[model samples]
Target: MSEILTITTDEVVPDREAVFEHQGIPAGRAVAAEIEALCTAAMEVFRQAAAPAGVLAEISKADFATLYKGDGQNEDATPVDEIYPRAKHLALFAVTVGEEVSRRIADGFKSKDFVDACMLDSVASASAERAVEIVQQRFLERATARSPAATKGEHRRLAGVPTGETPVPQFSSRAEKILDISSTGGDRRSPVDGVLAYSPGYCGWDISGQRKLFEFLKPETVGISLGESCLMQPLKSVSGVFIIGPKAIHLFDNCYSFCGRCTTHNCRDRIRALDAGG
Candidate 1:
């Protein structure tokens, strides 16, 4: 079964910079007032048109062994025993702003509404960003409040998001949650203070790897689908495997966020500085 959740999509609060970035506006033409006005109007469309949604599924530890092995994850160990070393429980997630965002994008292009298309593009990206954060926040709260306290479990990163803008050699999580190299070693542990996301594609699992994720997720319950190529259909959707446990933490040098690549200040959570934008 899937657990559905809500997230804010009110007033996109247009970030002119993000709009320009999305529009591929040249740096030389950035100061154009005409473009700015267009972006502002697009933001209004997002507020009125976008509807963000979040859904999650609970996978017990019992199926871990069979799941990884059958997925052809086998390399050295029996696959399952190799990838999923420890801990309990798994949460599969998918978040989207629905087809309305795309419909708006199509309508914009058809009517010569460049700003509408571009800003709606920004909204699609922005909605996916916020929806996932809300879902992760909710997951962490639940994982931490349980009887044993989620923080106590040593984290074992089987899969999740890249820790930062720069790629690390190992397990990925939010940069702040990532530890220094000195802490790197066997079974690294940290307080289960937050939830981290991972997908098949992140840790080298490609479209083929997603089969296990979808089979286990049964995303249809939440209106998500893996296309013939394994990409999410809505195009604006986000999917990942997440869990809360100390061992889930991965070590790295100077952990950075993927947001480091973005120069836009449009996102509410946009890390203004390149340094530790947690």
Candidate 2:
């Protein structure tokens, strides 16, 4: 189906606070105990102060030959293939944490409570990230089951398990069964095949890109809107496109490699932390 597909779900707001591996909260990488205490307290407040905000999404893949086909993929094409090689499909998607979190932050700012504001920020970030995960999980399950990957035969690393690996298995009865099923032609289809997610104002994709995403996703169906500056209105919200092919791993792992493309240096640390995250 060439038409865009939409997904919606009520995600249980993740019950945790955002933490950085090298944050200088009280000081550089403050004691985990102290941070945990702070996070626990903040999360307690957030639990009541906020409610589960869901996710909204739109996903579609277009022919690479059009707006995104790299260079040599087509003989008439130019040098883009060198920059982004072997990209078979462009998967565009946008997901957002809902409006209630925004209400919490606005209320915090109104009272001039920085601590509360920061806690809310952590919760909002967690919620937004969760929103994307929820949407992706749903989309992938739906997409792969009905996608070409399922019907069209493609070479994928088939399910396999080696025998006599003491570290993993000691050639037990299960190992014999495993080796038997480890054939050359097996399907490992996934909607998130080497996905390279690009959010508006993120990963070198300019904030201005949100207009295109918004127009495509119509995120307003789930109460998401963009501000005049192209930032998603919920503040904690995120939007992006995905490149789902093997060549996209590098961008998916470190999107900031294209940092030079964006002029806004405001969120470098935050973006870096997210990229470095496991």
lDDT of each: 0.55, 0.45
TM-score of each: 0.63, 0.57
| Best-matching candidate per TM-score | 1
lDDT per residue (tens digit) for residues 143-229 in model 2: 545544311112111112232222123322332222222223445323133333445444444456566666655756556687787
Give the runs in model 2 whose Cα sits over 4 Å from its true position.
1-12, 15-17, 20-35, 49-92, 147-192, 247-278
lDDT of 1 by residue, 19-80 (tens): 56556765556466766776677677777777677778876766644454445643332212
RMSD of 1: 8.5
Error of 2 at 188 (Å): 14
Worst 10 residues of 2 by lDDT: 150-159
Q: How many clashes show up per model?
A: 15, 3
Of the candidates shown, which would achieve the greatest lDDT relative to the real structure? 1
